[model samples]
Each structure stands twice: as structure tokens, then as C-alpha cells.
Target: MTYIIGRGYGRALLTPDGIFFKGPFRRRSIPWAEITEIEKRHHTARSSEWWDLRLVRANGRDLAVPGAFTSNRYDHKFEAKLALLREYWQRAAR
Candidate 1:
């Protein structure tokens, strides 16, 4: 069984073969074999804040996990989830 973490109303799941993400508007799966890179992006301007987690595939497509961020200065839970994803992704690849 895959381990899943709840991200607000969405969720991120790590399975034996891939990663699964479900958000309000989109759902995505990235097989370990197809993943070329994973990245975290953040942008803050004036009163707005944005954070995204992106997975780059070997076929040149990118899948993003939206709503994985907060405007608050300390988001330990968010950071932990991102770290967990990275760690499990590496493990699945191996």
C-alpha cells in the first residue's frame, strides 16, 4: 500500500512504482522511471505568495503539485512534506 499525506483538501501519495497527486483541478502520476527531476519553487511579491512542487519527466513534461504552500513565515509541516516526497522518490527510484 502507498503512503499518503493530506495536503489541505488535496493529497500526495507515494506508491511502490510512482507518485500520485490530486488537487482541485488536476490529478497527476509520475512513475519513478519517468522522473528526471523534482523541484520546489517559491515566489513572493507584495501581498502575494506562491509555492509549487514540480516534477520533471524524462519525456520533457512537467507535473506540478499546486497549493503546497503558505504565506506564513514558518511552515514546518509544508517543509516536512516536501522533504518526505524527495526522500521517498529517491528511494523508489533505487
Candidate 2:
């Protein structure tokens, strides 16, 4: 389970097991099996808003996800990060 916290550069992934983040900016890491799902959504700063959302998953979890990370805002700065998670997931899945 993971969710996006903050906005844009301040985005962070809140994983149930471990919160993944990179300073004031969102970092991309290898997608992981534990991830369950990664959703790219920008809910209105207003409460009670749900739309303009995109997500990815490994299991059956659907938590909030940041865009800066998945979107490669840093030009794949998160490649390693995502790779790490993906590597772990691959091993686990195997």
C-alpha cells in the first residue's frame, strides 16, 4: 500500500511497509511487488475529490501515488529507485 503525500516537488510515496521519498522531490524506484499498486492522481486540494487519477499495482492495493516519481520528472532519476524495488519484487515473485 502506498499513497502520494504533499504536492509536486514535495511529493512522497507512503508505503504501508516503508515510506519511500527523496528530499523535497519525489524519487522513482523500481516498481515493487509489495507496491500492490501505484496510482497517479491529483485530487483537488479540496476535500472529497476523486478523479484525474492513474495507477499501477502488483497485488490488490490501491493507495494514493505521486506523479513526479512515476512521471520521471527528473529524467529517470528514479530509475535506480524503481529498479531496486523491481529487483526485490522479482526475487519475491520467483
Candidate 3:
């Protein structure tokens, strides 16, 4: 399954092996066993509040699941997406 992020430009792909992320400039793959944490992150800039995901790896790398466009303000089903991601992580992570 795949989750669209930030106006459909970014995405997170979930598979039996792990999760994959592709953004404008970077790409990352995290195996289920290597994931150490999955958490929601809140960012505020001036008058806007943004919600995104923070995934930590065993090697201490952090990955963000984009929830909104860089030029956009409102979140798009952030809580729902986060919950779903967590569900997958819980089932797969060791």
C-alpha cells in the first residue's frame, strides 16, 4: 500500500518487508526490524501548524512523512495516516 503526501508529490510505500519514502530530493527505505520509533511531530511556523511523522531507525536516522505541502498550511488527514502507519509498524516491527 501507498500513502500520498503533500499534494501527491511525496509518498510512503508499505510492503511486507518495510516502508519506503520518496520525496523531491531524497529516498529512503526502512526495514521493519530496523525501525526504532514511530511518532507524530508538530511544527509551527509563524501562524501555521504542520503535522508530520518522525521515524527513527536503530542507527539513529530520522525520516519524516510529509503531511502537507511546503507552501500549504492545513494538514490532510494526518491523524488517520499516522494511526495507520503505527498499526503497520506495530504488526511488523520487532
lDDT order of candidates, top first: 1, 3, 2
lDDT tens per residue, model 3, 1-94: 2344342577788877888877765687888788889876667879776566788889998776654233334445665677778888888855
Tens-digit per-residue lDDT, 4-81, candidate 1: 133445667788788887866558776888888888778788978767677788989876654466665568877876
Q: What is the lDDT of candidate 2?
A: 0.44
- Cα deviation at 72, candidate 3, in Å, is 11
Per-residue accuracy of model 2 over 12-59 as CA lDDT, tens digit each: 454434445453444654344445543434454444543322335555
**lDDT measured at residue 54 in model 3 versus the true structure, 0 to 100:** 80
Order of the predicted models by TM-score, top scorer first? 3, 1, 2
Give per-residue lDDT, candidate 2, residue 24. Answer: 47
- List, in order, the clash count of every candidate structure: 0, 13, 0
Task: Find the candidate with the highest lDDT and give its number.
Answer: 1
On a 0 to 100 scale, what is the lDDT of residue 32 in model 2? 49
In candidate 2, stretches whose alpha carbon ends up further than 4 angstroms from where it belongs are 1-59, 64-74
Candidate 2 weakest lDDT stretch, 10 residues: 1-10
What is candidate 3's TM-score against the reference?
A: 0.72
